[model samples]
Each structure stands twice: as structure tokens, then as C-alpha cells.
Target: MGIGDVSKRVLLGRKLRSSQLGETLLPKRIALPVFASDALSSVAYAPDEIFIMLAVAGASAYAWSWKIGLLVALVMLTVVASYRQTVHAYPSGGGDYEVATVNLGRNAGITVGSALLVDYVLTVAVSISSASQYAAGAIPALVGHEATAAVVAVALLAAVNLRGVRESGTFFAVPTYLFMLAILGMCGYGVMRLLAGDLPEAESADLVIEPAAGWEGPLGQVALFFLLARAFSSGCAALTGVEAISNGVPAFRKPKSTNAATTLLLLGLIAISMMMSVIVLAKQMSIRYVDPHELDRLRTAGGDALPEGYEQHPVISQIAAGVFDHFPPGFYFVVTVTGVILVLAANTAFNGFPVLGSILAQDGLAPRSLGSRGDRLAYSNGIVFLAVLSMLLIWIFDAETTKLIQLYIVGVFVSFNLSQLGMIRHWTRHLRTERDPAARRKMVRSRAINTFGLTLTAVVLAVVLLTKFIAGAWITIIAMLVFFLVMRAIGKHYEEVELELAADEQDKVMPTRVHAIVLTSKLHKPTLRALAFAKATRPNVLEAVYVDIDSRATNQMLREWDERRLDVPLKVLHSPYREVVRPIVDYALEIRRANPRGVVAVFIPEYVVGRWWEQLLHNQTALRLKGRLLFAPGVMVTSVPYQLESSQAARDRRRRDDHRVKAGDLRRGRVVRDDDQNQVGR
Candidate 1:
């Protein structure tokens, strides 16, 4: 009906009724990629990190790669199992924050919330960064501009996520699955080659790696253990998105927890297998991977640097290149799918952030706006917020996965450890109240699972802290602290406001007297009408108050009032400050303090016009005066609308179009229809 509506439909497509949300409920087939992409996608960069840590002390430390990967996998499996319990026990979608807060106290919950929030933002940043790298690999022209490409990828991700979750998920599902297939397919072929003793080394295998400043020549146990710990910490990146399924349980259909748990288990198995296999293949193939910028440090046996601009491909890139050494198309396919999967990985955060935001809003920790569902049954505000925050981070970090990944898993593990501890406490408390033997037995078993998860994750959290605190873990710690404080402040403010504005016995008490004031700028029809309306209320005292900034105008008004002999007295207050609202508010407050039990009713005449710009020209002062007066104790500010000639047209248009489009609708064009997802919002 309007240009505003027209633009929205163009960007976000047609508007659907709020009742059709169920139509967006994900089936298992689509749901897997929607939520699992983050953890699954981490394999692309996680292995590279592990190799980097190992190569720090030279390649001799490389033997620890598989051991660290196995340890990380074991921890991941524990985390997944624990979260399966989390989803089942708490499926309202608050995830770790809700569980920790409910069981471990508000402090723990806030910690988890901050961690989760930070993690979600990084999920977008890291995923988009990885996608950019993959994009560069696929297209040589994008080489030096990978950071720019990464940022563009993030921008594209933000746009798609703005549409809504189910829609975005469906769109991302294909690439995520393709990535899984590619990696799994690569690993399977590498296994066959290994069996046949014919696998080729990576193209860059001949390039030597010079260790960082500290490790010149190290067979020392201390250096080896340190390298192993660092590698283990780096491999921990694989666990970054494991908690998403727990956070996103409600996104599933009926039996939400069961569906979510199954997804989690499948994610763990697939991720562990894919990751371990890739790491093994890379080592066996003698993939000469190093930090791209550090490639000049690498030298061949003859002591010559491998050549300038020697583009070292990523772990997957190396594997893909080696596996498809002769078959160029297979390498291209792997690169293409890897790029798609990395970009799509952000969808996991898109799904989780909105759901968590809705829960936070309900608990009065976030803005009430997040509590409302959009036409697509999604928490649209939350989704957009996540997108914008992630985009900002992506831009700031230049979408370099290596740089962005520094801020990655610390938050996720913070949530993981806290959530598990909370679940353990939850089981303990539940067991105390349980009378039924079978349910009690189940609780005991769950407690055991959670306890194991807590131990494992706590160790991982400690390892991450010890190994990475200086390597950007502190950034995440600071972020969690910031989020925790913010949530607490929001909660406090909401509580205070709720208490101050609360309707109760005290609020119902009537004032001893009512003193009504009519604001008059001139003796026009509108001012006269407001005067008459104020008098009809029959207050104990009634006065027409005018701010006398202009003496000539005030004199003319006084003379007219005197000649007319109006029923209510006219009081003109001189404002040397020439302030419109301040003088009126001070006058009202003086009357209130003099008679503390009396109520002040301030009535201002306001102009209502049809066109948008026309309305801005009139009644600005009256609106300001009314706004100021409302803050006074025992004061009621009312706007008496004087309809302009154009107002009728505006009203007719409003009558023809009635819809409440809150946030996130500015981009959508107006094409309203009954969409399935919108049904949930109804």
C-alpha cells in the first residue's frame, strides 16, 4: 500500500500471517545442516591450527597431532552427550544460559550467556573468513583480496539470515551436505590410497618449516609437552559449535529434544571421523602447511626458501590437491563445496541466536522486542542483531579465519563447562526431590553423564585458558564479563522499572484534589476546544496556562481573554529562558509540591495531519510539554487531538492499511499472504 511496504517485499519477499510459523519447523533432513554446520565446518580450519601448533617446535612435534585430535574428539563426544541431556531437560531454547542460571545461580547463567553471545558472533566471523579462503582457492583473482572477499561473504550471509531461519536453513542445507560429502569422500579415497601404498604428498611437501623464535632444536620433553598442549588447545576449535544443538532444541518438530540429541550424536560422529581422518591424511601425505605469511621461513633440503608467493593451501586444500592431483575437477569441486559449507556454517548461529534472544527477552534480560515473533515465526529482531554484530566483527577482523579464530572457542567452552556444571547440579537437586525409583534412576544416570561432561569440559576450558589466554582467550573472557554485567544491569533496570510502575494498592489511591491546566498558545478553535474540554472535567481548580515568551503575543492573548471573559482563569508565566517545556513543567511541579496530595492534569491541544511531513510542522511544543509533564509526580499528561483538514485522508488510508510491522521489516516489500511460518506468530 505504501513505498515503505513496497521496499520490504522487494528485499524480504512477501509478508506472511503470523499463524503459519509451524510451516517453518525443520525436518531432520534439513535440520542437520541448519544447526550442525558450525561444528562440521570447523574441521576446515581446526586441523590447520593443530598442524600450526605442532610445527611451532619443528615437524618433530607432529606426532602429537593424532593424539591431540583424539583427545579433542573424546571431549567433544562427552560434550555432545552432555548436551543431549541439556536439550531433553531444558528445551525452551535458552540453552546454557537458562540451564546454568536455573541450576547454578544467576552468576553462572550470566557467564554462560555472555560466552554464548560472543561465540555466536565469532561463529559468523570465523565461518565467513573460512569461506573467503576457500573462495580464494577456487578463484585465483581473489587471492590478495581474500579479506575483502571474506567481508563480502559475511555481508551476503547477513542478508540471507535477515529473511528468517527456516528459509535460510533450507538455502544453506545443500552446501553443508555437499561439504560433508566432499570431505568424507576425500577421506575415503585417501584411505584406499593408503591401503594401496600409492598416496602422493602435497605439492608443497618439499618446503621446509623453520620453527618460531623459541624452538631451535627440541627433543626435550618440556618442549614437546608444551607443543602438545598448544596443539590440543588449537584442536579445541572443533568443539566451538557443539552447544548449538542444545540451544536450538525448540527449532525441531515434536519430540524436540530427541530430535536435537540425535542430531548432536550424528554431528559428533561425523565431525570426529572427518577431522581425525583429515589430520591423518595430511600427516601421511607430508602436507607442507604453514601460516601463509610464514611460508618464507620454510626452506627445501638445499636451504633455499620455497620461492616467493608460494601459496600454501589449507589442510583440506592440500588433501584435495593431492587426492585429485591428476583430476583437476575433483580439486575444484572440493574447493567449491568447502567454500559453500563455510559460508553456510553461520546459519547455525542464525538459528541459535534468535531463539536464545527470545528466551532472554521473556526473562526480562533483553529488550521486550525480541519476545515478539515475526511474520515468519522467527525472532526477527534477534536474527538481525546477530547478523549486524557478526558483520561488524567480520569487517573488523578482515574475515581472516586465522585471526578471527583466535576469538572463537573460548566462549563456546565457557558455555559448555558452565552448562554441564549446572546440569550436574540440576540432577543432584532433582534426585533429592524424586520419589519414583525409575525416574530417580534415570536422573542418577544423567547426573553421571553430566558429571563426566563437567570434568572433561572443565579440563578443556583450563587447557584453552592456559594455552590461549594470551593468544586471544582473554578477549573472550572480557567479552563474557561484559555480557554478564550488561545482562545484570538490564535485569536490574527492568526490575526497578517494574517495581516503580507497578499497579498495586498504592497506585489505586485517589489524590485529595484535582488541579487541571489547559495549555493555550492562542485563542484559536483548537485551544478554545481544549479549554472547554478541561473545564468539563470539573476539577477543584482549573487554569489556562500560557508560556509568555513573546510579550506582544502574550499581551494580545491576555487582552482577548479579558474581553472574552473566559470562564477559566488564564495564567501567563514569563520564561526568560525562552524555554517552552521547562517553564510549564516547573509551574506544574510547584503546584504539586505546594499541595502534595493533589493531582495535576495537564491537557495540551495537538494537531493531527494526514501526510507525514505536514504533521511535523504543527504541535511540536505541545508534544514536548506533555512529555515533560508526565514525569512529575501525581501528574497526568493528556493530548487532546485537533484534527487538521488533511487528517481525514490520513485516517482513510490508515483504515485501508492496518498492520504492525516492527523491526526487521524495512527491507521486505509489501506482498502479504498466508505463509506457513507466519502461522506460529499468530
Candidate 2:
């Protein structure tokens, strides 16, 4: 093997064969973590968002946190229920995009795709940023460097996800369940303390949050309503991962749709319970919270700014600290797990985004690269793309969850509202054709569910837009528009290519004559080798061609051609503009125009090298020539590579990389990733 292959294997682990894909298919235990991590991780920071919004009006607004949580819960329940219908209706894993396209037309499908693309990007950004903040709070050395930490977290998450959805899901399920258990356990204990009339106070309970500029003091009823709306909109981050279940129904074992729907329902219930409990507990304990930048506004009981370097823990962290203060280790455990869950939450996006991208690619709405599966049956390119984009956002925003959260939930709510509206249309259209009485009743019932979901989510989207458009919602809107145009362009290009490649009698008919052109930079072994190969082909016409960008080089080559008396005829194309591709492309087109039935075979002599820099040194001209030639009609470009000696080292490196320890290496016996999987024996 080559050095490149060795490096990849050493860094990324073994390259699983196509037959070993079954080893990557995760069971329910692991799948839950992989798919549910994002929603479960929201408990780490969702409570903090609710409290921060409520803290704008001093302690009085804090009472409404629970109410907002319940509202979010209601919407989440409706959304989960609606998606259950979707999974059953479209078991193909196309999710909302498929639902909309099947019923609402191509435009709606494109809209859903755009919205989902934006939402997935935001999911990675928000989750990683939240995890970074949590880490900063837990580790003092991490302060002021959370942005860097967030990027690193994103890289790690991407690596895990590139291992494949089922495998990532299995690894994630533990953290998802652990996070759920930890928060629920803490909430239950806090309730017991409340009943005993000895519930402890939060660390921030003694601190006061001074509201930001316009959010202060007693306001009119309209203003109050607006404030509440803004708060509700922010709390909707909990719904970011809800659509994933619809996109991942096919990942489940037998009865994929049924299992996915059940998982979705469990996610909703768990999320609601966790979010509401955290909010209520924070309110009861007077947990003080503020936007990251406004941390300067919070003061202690003695009317002093809290210590300089003071790390403001999140509401859940504060609650955990207070609730488990007597057990120091337990407090740290809770905090650690919460942070871990946030990072893991991004796993949901990793699983969902690639699946969606693959479907889009299959339909020619996304780049073909998205449809390319890796050795482990994972959409690796998609994972890498998300990771890089998320890293940029984290770095730009300093990994401050408060700042990043502004850009969080808008796209999700947009998708939800559109998807629910589309689902209503889908059921209505189906009911027209599906005339069985029982089926009609079911469709009507499903439509009602979707209708309610649409109404609820539309209101949330409007609130989100009103509150966050200036803050960051425009970012989401712009991203959606960009994706919409890109996808449309891809679809158009694919259609154009399909039309261009359509076959007829002319396509099958052999060319009337073959015209050969050999690219000659200088008269050497490469040029001589090309001449011999062309002679072997015995084309009707053959000549050596060179772009004369410089007079001295052309004159020197012409004199050499005369002195050497080369077998092939030499022809130089004059170009005063010093262009590389355009002149050659035009010449090839002119040749095709002269004889429409002729095939112009352009042979490019290229050097094959092992090192990255060697590639830069060689094939600079041939690569560009080939790219331009492909766009010209009736032309075929072939690379005739003479492998350089450096390539041998690369080959050796590749062989070493593919060598791996087998399944039975351990004393405890073999540990197969997927139990039902079997090896592809040689």
C-alpha cells in the first residue's frame, strides 16, 4: 500500500469492507444514543435559555419559565405525533421533504430541503458551542478558549459520526440515557427536598441580574405579550432535533417506521419532562442567569460585582450544584454528563443530515458527493462538511452558547411549520384517491393532527422571526436561500446532463474517423511514448499540438522537431493572450465542427507522484486541459501517466495501513460490532 493509505488507516482506523457493513448496523440500545442524543442534550442548556429570557424582567418574569417550558412541551408533543404519522406514511426515509414533494409539489420539497440544510448546520453550531461553555465552566483553564475547544469538540464528533450512523448511535445512546437519568434523578430529589421544606438555594440565588437596555421595568400589556413571545421563541430550541426521527426511520430494525415512531414519542416525553422540571426548579430556587456578555450586570448580596473570572454556571448546572452540594462528586458528575450530552447532541445532526443529503443526492437536488458512501457505509463527506462549518461558527461566536443560541431554533421551526402544512396537504390529496371509508377516516385524523401542529409551529416561527431576525435569523434565511438556489442549480444541471447523454442510433454508431492530438510540452521520452501509442492506435489523422504562449519556446521546439525529424507532424496553436484552456477548447470545438462524426482524442502525458508537493509540480497543465476539454463536444481526454519513482513509497504505505488485528484478538473472545454480522472470509 501507499503512504497516503497508511496515514489514513492509522488516523481513521481500519477500512471496513462493503460486506462488513452489517457490523456497523447498531442495535436499539446504541441507536437511541445516536439518534436521541441531540434532544436529550438540550436539558444541559435549554433551561439556561428559558431562565435568561425570563431574567430580563427581574424575578417576577421568572415565574413564567415553567409556563413557557410547558408550551414548548406541547408543541414538541404535537410535532412528535405528527412525525409518527410521517414515518408510517413514507417509510422510505425521505422524511418531510418527501412528504412535501409527494403532496405539495417540487417547490415545497425544495423549501423543506433548504430549511433542513440550514437547521442541520445550526444544530452542529449550537450543540458544540453549548458543550464548550459547559467545559469552560467546569475547567478553569478552558476560559477564554472555549471557541477553540468547541472546534476540537466538533472535530471529535465528526470523527465518531464518520464511523457510520448505526455505530455512532450505539455509542451515543449511553450518554443520552445517562443524561436523562441524571437530570430526572436530580429533579426528583429536589422535589423531595421541597416537600421536606428544606430545599437548598442555588449558588446564584444571592446574585441579581440587571436587565439589558430595552427589556427593563413595568411595560404595557402589548410589551409584556411581546416579551413572553420572545421568551417562548427562545425556548423552542428543544424542538431542533424532532424531525430527525422521520429522516431516520429506515435505520431502525424490523418494523422500522413503528420503532422510529416509538423512539420519537419517548424523546418528546423525556424532553418535556426534563425541560419543564429544570425550569420549575430554577424558578423555585431563584437561580440567577444572564447573557454571556452581560455577566458584568450580575451582583452579589453586598452590592458588589461577583469576582472577576467568575464563571456563571448554567441554570441546570446551578440547580445541580445546589441540589447535590452535599455530595461534591455527584455535583461534578451531573455537570460532566450534562456537558458530554451537549457534545453528543450533535450526533443527532450527524445521523440526520447525511441521510437527508443522500436522499437529496439520489433525487439530484444535492451534490453527488453526498451520495458517496464511505468504506464503513457512512456519508463521510457530509460529516466533514458539517464539522468544518460548525467549527467556523464556533470560532466566530467564541463558543458562547448565549450568542450562538440566537441563531439556533429559527430554521427548525421554519421546517416544522412548513412540514406540518405539507403533511396536511399530503393527507388531503391522498384522501381524494384513497376512497376506502376506514382509510379516509385515518387520513382525516392525520390531517387534523398535522393542522394543529402547523398552527402551533407557525406561531412559534413568527415569534422567532420577530425576536431574532436582527439578532441572527437573517443568517438562517440567507443560508436557506443559498441552499435553495444551489440545490435548484444541481437539479437543473443533472437534468441537462441526462438530456445531453440520452441515447439514439447516433450514440451507438461508431465515429466516421478518429482525430488524435498529443499534448507536447518538450521533446522527451513522454512525447516519444505518446507518438508510439498514437501510431499503435492507427488513427485517420495524428499530430503533436502545443499552445505557443511564448515565441522562444515554440521556435526552440520547431527547430528541435526539424533537427530530430520526429515521426509525428508538429502543429503549434498561436495564442497572444497567454491563455491555457480556452484556446485549446476552442480549437477542439472547431475540429468537431469540421467533421461532426469525428472523435477528437486528446492524450495528455501526466506524471504520477507519491508526495503531495510532487503532484503540485506535475500535471498542472494536463488537469486544466482535461477539465476544459470535457465541456467541449465530441472530445475525449485521456491521461497517460508515467509513474514517477516516488510513487513506490506511497504504494508501500497503503499496504501497511490495511493490515489490522482481527476480531478474536482479545482473551475475552471476539467482540463483533454488530452481533448478526459475519466476516467476508478470503
Candidate 3:
């Protein structure tokens, strides 16, 4: 139809009617990648974070890597189990926010909502930033421009997601599955090599790690405990995306809760296995990894620093290199899929955040626009909002995964702790009236699971605050506070507006009289049409009003009006300041003040043009006058459109679009061929 419409059609495909929303429901196969990619992709960076935190104490502390992995796995499993109960209980898809609100109080619900919103934004930032790091390492061209690459990646991801959840999920399902296969296949082969006693060491195995300042000697139990706690806190990033599935339960097809619960189980198990495998394999292969910024800590066995510009590979990459040493394709495939999957991991957030935003909007805690679906049946506003916020974070942090990682997980854990606590309360409250013995037993079991989850997550949240507050976690806390305050203010505003807009008996009363004024600048077709329309309304009083910015034209129009012997009277208001809009506005306000029980109707003629540039050529005064009159009490502004000849172009374009053939026209028997029409006529 138009350039913009064609471009949008190409980018987002054809728009679907509201009835097609059911067609967009994701099956379990597609839902896994859509909702679980974030949790699954964490294996790509969780192990690296674990090693980086442990590297501060040098490689000697690396022996605890597997222990931290196990601890994280335990927390992840507990969270997954807890959320299964959540999905079953709250299949309407409010997830943590709903649970907290219903069981706890409004404040607690808002806290969970604010926390989840912040976490979803951070999910996209961290996931895409990590992907950028992998890409930079694989392709040296992107080394210095990681932030730029990350921003572009985020933009493209948002575009794909704007097409709708089911479509985006189908698109991302391939890479997500490939990543799972690559990592699992690599782990399986690595385990086989280990069993055969032929597993080779990583490329960095020969390098020795030097402990940072104050950690050169053996540490006391207190120091060791603190070091382990920091490492564990960082490792717990694996649990970040577990709640997304709970938030996205409605996206799944038939038996939504069951499919979602199954997906969550698969996510937890696969993520745990991959993370544990990577950490164990790295340990077995003696992968000497450290913070990328602190590469100086790595030295050769002869006490010599590494060659200048030596780049340290991530833990998974090193393990892939060692495991696939004999097969170059295997290594490349693993690396390629790992990078791709990290980018697609942001898709999970893209889906979850919008749905959560919609829920918040429905609750009056977010802008109403967030609750509306775009033409493609997606929450386009929410998606764009998340993308912009994430790009800002990526730019601010320079797309450094390590730096961004510190601000990660804090919000998710905040939601996790509150959600689990709420779930416990949920089951407790239901058990009071759930007198069926079988259902009561089930409720008790779920409560116990939630209780355990709460204990573990509470401990993790405290440890995260304790270990990461100075390491940039404070930024996340401040962000959550800002979200909380903003949402509260929005809810309050909505409530006040609802009260103000409530209709009263006085609202039904009609105005005592109608005072009509047709705004005229010249005695031409548009002005004549406006005057005729105003007279047709049969108001109590009617006059043609003009703002005399140009006296000569005004006098000439007056002479023509008198020559034509027009029945309607013309009233001219002289403007010394050459202002056209203010005089009309003041006149209308004066009339409104004089007749408080009456309505003043101002009629203005506006030109309708087809070409975009023609719009700026006319209607300037009418636009300004209408804008001013809208705010005056009891004043009504009506636009009488005068379509120019060029306006036919827009009407013709719409007519052509209406006849365009769509995909299902043939099958639906809606297509008509000229030949068929002629035969029917005969």
C-alpha cells in the first residue's frame, strides 16, 4: 500500500486477526526453546563466572569448582520443583507476581513485580553481552566493538520477537536444540575420553595462576569461607531464568500447566548437567582460566609472563578445544552453536518481560500501552522497551559479561525468595478449606517443597547481597526501588483517574443552548462549507468569526460577503500582535464564561491532502485554534474536512490494498478470476 506498510509487512509478515491467536499457541517442542533458553544457555557462562571468582585465590581454589556447581544445581532443582507447583496453581500466567499478590499483600506483590521486571531486562543485557564476548573471541574483527555488536544483536532479536511469540519460538528452536546437542555431545565424548584415560589437557594447562594481593599464602578458615561464598554466589547465576517458565505458562498449548511444568523439569535437568559437565571437564583438563581483565595473573611454568596479547578463552571453549582436539569441525560447531544460543537466550526474556508487562498493565501498575498487542499479536511496546533498556546497559557496561554479571541474578533472586515464600503461604491458605484428603496431602507436599525452596533461596539472596553489594549489585537494588516507586505511582494515578472519571447524575444534563461559530480566514469553498454546516445545526446563536491578521484581505472578504448578501453575520476580531490562534481561543473562552450552562461549538475547516508534503501547506491556523479551544470548559471543536483532488490517491491506494490476494484466499474460495466471472455472467 505504502512504503512504510510494505516494509512492515516484509519485516513482520502479514497481520493476523484476533481469532488467530490460538494458532500462535506454542507446543511443548517450541515452548522449551522460547521459555527455557535463558536457563539452558547459562551453562555457557555460569562455569566461566565460577572460575573467574575462584581465580582471585589462584588455581589452588579451583578445586571447589565442582562443589559450587553441585550447590547451584541443588538450588536450581529446588526452584524448578517449586515453580511446578506455581504453574499448576496459577495457570493464568501471573507467575511470581500473582502468587505474591494473592498470598502476601499488595506491597509484596509490587516488590515481586518490580524485581521480575528488572531481572527480565538484565536477562537480555547479560545474555546478549555474553554472546558478544564469544563472537569477539571467535572473530577478531569484533574485538574492540563488542558493545556495538551487542547493541545490533539486541535490536535484531527484538525485531524477530515482535513477530509474535510462537513465530519467534519456532525461529529460535533450531539454534537452541543445536546448542543442547553440541554441549551434550561434547560432554558425552569428554566423559568417554576420561574413561579411556586419554583425555588431553586444555591449551592453558601449562600456565600457572598467581594469587592476588593478600592471598599469596595459605588462608584461614574465615578467608577460605568468604572466598568460597563469593564463588558460590557467582555460580548461582544458573538459577536466573528458572522463573521465566512460570511467568510464561500461558504461551504453552493444551494442558498449558503440564507442558510448562515438563519444560521446566527438562530445563533444570539439562542446565544442571551441562554446567556440572563443563566445570568437571575443565577441572579434569586443568583449564587455567582467570578474569579476562587480569590476564597478567597467568604465567608460564618458568615464571615468565605469557606472550603479549595472549587472550584467555572461556571455560567452555577451552573444554571444547581439549575434548575435540582431533576434530576441528566439532570444536567449530560447538563454538558456533554456543555463541548463537547465547544470543537466542535473550529470547526467553523477550517473551517473559512483555507478558509480565501486560499483566502489570492490566493491574494498573504499568502503562496501558504495554497491555495492547501489536498487529502481529505481540506486545510490541514491551519488547521495544526491554530492548532499549538492555542496549543502554550494554553500552554503559561496554558489553563486558563479567562486569554485567555482577548486576545479574540479584533481581531474579529477589523474585525467587518472595515467590517461594508466597507459594508456601498459598498452599497453607488453600489447605485450610481443601478438605479432600488426597488434595490436602498434595497441598502439604507442595508446601514442604516451597518451604525448602524458600530456605535455600533466602540463603542465596543473603549471600548475593553480602558478596556482591560492592561488586555492582547495589545498582540492581536501586533499579528495583525505582521500578517499585514508579509502578506504585502509576497505580495511584490510575485509581485517582478512575475516581475522577466516574459518571454522575449531573453528567447526563444537556447544555441549555448551543452557541455556534464558524472560523473563517477567507470567503472560499472551505469557509462557505463551514458556515453552511454551522447553520444547518440550528444553534441558538450562530456567527462567522474571523481573526484579522491581515486587514486588507479581511476588508476584501467583508466586501465580497456583503456583495453576496450572505444571511449569516460575520464577526471580525482584530489581532495587533498578528496572532491568529490566541484571539479565537480568547473569544471562545469569553463566550463560554458568559454562558456557563451553554456549550460553544467552534467549526473549523481542515484540508485533507494525499501527499505527505501537502499537509504542511495548509490547515495551520485551524490546527492551532482547535488545540487551544479543546482545553476551554464547555467548548467543542469540530473539524469539517475539505478533501483536495490529490486526496483520491490515498483512497485509491486503500481500494487496491483491499483487493490484494492473501495466502488463504484460494483455499477459502474468496478469490475471483476474471474468466470465471465472465463465464458466470454468460
TM-score, cand. 1 vs. native? 0.90
Residues 1-682, candidate 2: write the lDDT tens digits. 5567667665566677788666676555666677777887777777777777777777668878888888989988999989989999898889989987877788789989889878887888888887777677668899899888888888988887776776677677777788888989999999888889888998888887776778687877998897788888888888888888788776777677778878888888888888888888888888888876778879888878888788777787788888887898878778878878888888888888888999999999988899888866888888887788788878887777667777788777777877888888888888879979998998999999999999998988888999999987887888888999999999999999999989888668889999999888899888888788887888899999988999998999999999998878998998889986777788889899999989998888888898898888888878888888888889988777777788877777666543443554443343333455743222
Candidate 1 Cα outliers beyond 4 Å, as residue runs: 14-18, 133-156, 432-441, 502-504, 559-565, 654-682
- Model 1: C-alpha RMSD to truth? 5.0
Error of 3 at 509 (Å): 1.3
List model 1 lDDT by residue over 372-411, tens digit each. 8775567878877887787787777776777777777889
Q: Give the TM-score of each candidate.
A: 0.90, 0.87, 0.97
Q: Write the per-residue lDDT of candidate 3 for residues 609-631, one digit (tens) a residue.
A: 98878888988877777777878
RMSD of each: 5.0, 5.0, 1.8
Q: What residue pairs clash in candidate 3, if any at all?
A: none
Q: After superposition, how far is residue 353 of candidate 2 from its true place, in Å?
A: 0.9
Candidate 1 CA-lDDT value = 0.83
How many clashing residue pairs appear in each of the predictions shown?
20, 14, 0
* Candidate order by decreasing TM-score: 3, 1, 2
